[model samples]
Target: MTDLDYRLEDFLSQVELEICEYLNKQKTKFPNSSKLLKRFTKRKDDWIHVSNHFRELKAKEKLGCKENSKSKEKTKLQDNIIIRNNELAEVVNELCIAKLFVEDITIDSIEYEPIVFKGDKSIDFHLRFIDGQTAYCDVKTIHPDDTGNWEQYQRALKNKLFPSHASFDLQQDSLGGILWHHSFASRTKMLEHVIEFEEKIVQKAINSSRKIMLFCGDGFRLSKDELEDFADFYYTEKYRKDDFMQLMEAYSMEKEAIILLRNIDYIAYFERKPMNLEYKFIPRVHGSASI
Candidate 1:
């Protein structure tokens, strides 16, 4: 199977496990909780369908079929679109855990295509804090494979066309990769919206200023050279150096709030062996919490 196929399988397995755990907890709350139990039980059939579909896709991949060809691959890709949806669910879970919120929050709480400007669009989470204050949290997930793609994406952003990718689907399209290249622009727009949202949230924080917490995975930070490459790619002759400097300053100021919880760190926290990527850049903010 392709790497994408393997990732999809891993993601689905995790989702199934999470669903089972949720049902188990609910069962403990009410011994004869037929309502929730029955709902989950019904989902079992759907999960089976998903598994069978994946098995068929795997068989095709083994036979060396065209990755993005129509037929089983396309069908499988469409069927497995839920994988990305599940990833979004995971992001929401991580956000809640990191933010220490008791209430159930979800990706559905986020507004997509929030506003369309001349150059960009935005997606942001509207989170309600424990202290009755609402904060707009912008969550970003980066993969180890993002360095090169991110540079290309930053270029697409300048042209005002966002590249799209079918990361959730089985059929990998070059067009999608091209679209993925546009992510940098889209993300830049998202960040701009986040700044505005942060201002509003800060104003709403009754007792204190609103906090903008950027929960990033290991892929978020790169080596100094990689960062410089991305900066060079995104910045133009007029604003390249200045933009790069401003970004560094901003990063320095918000280093504390910008948590780089790497995958290895996560594995280590869970008592597993550290995986890879040894000499990475990990800057920690010291002193005050405010940026």
Candidate 2:
């Protein structure tokens, strides 16, 4: 075989190995490995092209070409794919933990993929918190770099129009309420999901006498504006003017109590260094908590 062909084969092998390693370490169960293998084999073709180019230059006695391409820029695409996959795996692990936590809190039927409103969408987990009350939980992964986008979502929630997503609909039903936990990462997309989730799902839960709690696993922070926005939004959307006034009166009469749980231990690893963490709680007007 030519040098280009040999090098192309080597690159394909490495890509396949890396993909398999990731799948195994993440403990993913694929319904059909053969199908996935074929899909990945097609993806490997892109890398093979790069490898072949490098090999061609080497055969031509180019000074810069070594076993791999000398240009660092060529690897950027591959590097990004690797980074994204790593982040996804970390997020999955955190979701597993959140799932376990939900199970611990309730003995009621713990259902995954619970059908809602005759659609393909389904809630991640639904728990019966108590007699005649159910808690719905949706797990989201956020990356810290996207805080600004999440801030926008918090604003949208106050306005009552949520950006569309399949999972959002499942939590919107008039029955059990929703609880959204940022499983891992703190990206804008995750924050957006939370905002839409609160407005579309959790608020519905609160309306039905169920409560909502937002769990930020670790290494994530929320600004004052974000918290205040959440509080104002929940109050306005969830309660009528008179009921809100009654709640304020009750808080004053009872000497308003705030339960703060700081730095609760949960499993998460920062994808970058020197990670800073923040958590804020916004109490809903009628004794519901938003964080």
Candidate 3:
């Protein structure tokens, strides 16, 4: 095998080992709970995905040269795995976003956790483009709490208002699963809820002043089959305008929020997958943009 290829495979193996060790330690610490073990088992691809991207960064020398397996702080994924699932996803989003730039010929190099101004404030990534231009990028994952969906879903669960046939373990099930199960309710209500949810997300998203904003979410995961269906539909002009408009309205930015978004150069969404990393950069619009 080529040396570069060997290095990539070696890096992936090292990351996998580190993850196994970490999760095993967690399992030992919480013997009564199999949640950590179960999570790592089921979501093992997530670490692999991050590791692949990280290897790409390392290969391109885009990591600013300080990061290595031994340095926990420099290794963003290692330091981030200590928190909750959403936090873990956020770190994954950052690495995946970095991978996108690393692969892009327009980008020259990348720096993680770059300090752009005074105080302790920092952006998640600093991208130096090939044309001598640079941009500060930050990753934000819209948590279920950001839209009050978690609380509402919990209330629905407590009141036994969720679908009768739905079978879910509260701690083990994802918020996306709950939403999908409850999606059989009134269409109008669902549309309104979606719009309100997007409004809340857009409001929260505007709080960042970085040159680039990358928004991702735990509930926003799409299966490979679903992505295939979307790809087919995307290539065809079969989508109805009214339906598209309704979707846009559901995810549309508020008029006041437009000003905040306009201040940023670009905004993108991380199209999360269980085993893949894909991104969709939203084009700049005059007054309306979808989340």
User: Which numbered prediction scores highest in lDDT against the true structure?
Assistant: 3
Q: Candidate 1: misplaced stretches above 4 Å?
A: 1-89, 92-193, 199-209, 220-291
Which prediction has more favorable lDDT, 1 or 2? 2
Model 1 over residues 176-224: C-alpha lDDT tens digits?
Answer: 4433433333334324433444444434442342333333333323223
Q: CA lDDT of 222 in candidate 3?
A: 25
Name the candidate, 1 or 3, with the larger TM-score value.
3
TM-score of 3: 0.38
Better of 2 and 3 by lDDT: 3
TM-score of each: 0.35, 0.35, 0.38
**Mind sharing the TM-score for model 2?**
0.35
Single out the weakest 10-residue window by summed lDDT for candidate 2: 262-271
Estimate candidate 2's alpha-carbon lDDT, on a 0 to 1 scale: 0.37
Residue 42 shift from truth in candidate 2, angstroms: 18
Taking the tens digit of each residue's C-alpha lDDT, what string does model 3 give over 1-291? 347445634643543464434434433222322333344344545645555655665565554555455345336753332233444455545545554655577766666664433453345666677787776665655433222245544554676543343333444245554453332222223233333333433544534333654455433432222222222223332322222122322233342242121344544445664323444543221221121
RMSD values, in order shown = 13.1, 16.0, 17.4
Q: Residue-pair clashes per candidate, as listed? A: 7, 8, 0
Local error of candidate 3 at 217, Å? 3.1
Worst 10 residues of 1 by lDDT: 264-273
